[model samples]
Target: MENNIHGKVVAITGASSGIGEATAIMLAAKGAKVVLGARRKARLEALVKRIRVDGGEAICLETDIRQHNDLLRLVSLARETYGRLDVMVNNAGIARLSRIDDIRVSEWEEMIDVNLKGTLYGIAAALPVFKEQGSGHIINIISTSGIKIVPLQGVYAGTKNAIRTIAEALRQESAGLYRVTGISPGLVNTEMPDHITNEAARSAVKERAAQIGVTPHAIAGVVAYAISQPDNVDVGDIVIRPSVQD
Candidate 1:
């Protein structure tokens, strides 16, 4: 294996926008054959067109990360199209911020499903393919919220942290067979804040994001760096936040 970004087939979930979209563009620009998935079909179609127009190989599928079968299809599409799945980027996540007392049970369940179980499903879908190929990389898009627990973000942070722990465990288990990386991004300018149902929390987060959030491309560069490394080198955990983030 060349272990470079070029000519590698990378599958990305939540790729319609935000970090996933940025990562797909960056990777494809580097000569990667990117397979993108997300819930929004129109957005994904537009993105695929953009990548192809830019002279990069790309494909898109409507993937709801909450559905395990969707993840299987995403990975399968990568192999079927590109001959192999070099990397699986589980970048689909949601942040429904609320104080624990808010008792937003539905929101909590949504977070668990999309953030935690979703990552697990990506792993399950890719593991067999990775084992068969004897080489693969799993990248989980986590959040700095997990590292710095604060108000109204307990459950969201918990879900990210859960995946953080799992990524580490998977790394240890895979060892030489494959690589596992956890990317914990801080306030990034994305649509995540729009998903917050609480008006006050949403406003507050949006304000902070506007004030200090880094561009999604910043995180995409970090992902590119991780994937560009030699197979023997595993980039374990990365914490990317605005310099002024506290």
Candidate 2:
């Protein structure tokens, strides 16, 4: 049994699908009580049922991370149900890839709101509670796009890079008080590309993902590793991608 994750209360955003869903199941199986948040109520309900059937502790709340209050409520639910929040995974994100000249202003704004501000709101909601407990873990899901900086991914990568910067700074400031980890995953089979309004860009990304995307479970395993570490050891940053990805 993994003692570090067992019985820990973990709240995950974007829990309806992809990385979030995989992480929820993985951690819950390891004996963590998982509180799930996402905009899709029906999906959340189904996931909760699945976890229960598997004899794992789980709950769900309808959440839209673009709204700060939703994040607050998510953290509140974890604490209320489990008595303390052990980990907060800022995994909710959107991708609207387009060249800067395409002038897709609305798409840019959407990425900024969901990808950037949403992460900040999660930090706002969890930091105080983590501080109160004198110990906690934050795992922010980032992307390799932020590291490689490809064309048509300018805005999307920018948002991820911003979170990477913030997570690092928080790690530095928190010192021994809490743990901060940034998980930058390469193309995984997820619904993120579907959010792209640009048809051409969407098609290209989807093709690439279909060819080389790793399983969401792979990323979830990485998250478990970060959280399972001893309290004094912080798994600062993890960048994972397919071996074939350039």
What's the alpha carbon RMSD for model 1? 1.2
Candidate 1 per-residue lDDT over residues 4-116, each given as its tens digit: 99999999999999999999999999999999999999999999999999999999999988999999999889888888999999999999998899899999999999999
Tally clashes: model 1.
Answer: 0
Predicted candidate 2 versus true structure: per-residue lDDT over 89-143, tens digit per residue: 9999999888899899998899999999999999889999999999999999999
Q: What's the CA error at residue 153 for candidate 1, in Å?
A: 0.7
RMSD of model 2, in Å? 0.8
Looking at candidate 2, what is the lDDT of residue 18? 94
Clashing pairs in 2: none
The C-alpha stretches of model 1 lying farther than 4 A from their native spots are 1-3
Model 2, C-alpha of 115: deviation from truth (Å): 0.6
- The residue-level lDDT of candidate 1 at 72 comes to 94
C-alpha lDDT (0 to 100) for residue 153 of candidate 1: 92
Instruction: Estimate candidate 1's alpha-carbon lDDT, on a 0 to 1 scale.
Output: 0.93
- Model 2 spans with C-alpha error above 4 angstroms: 1-3
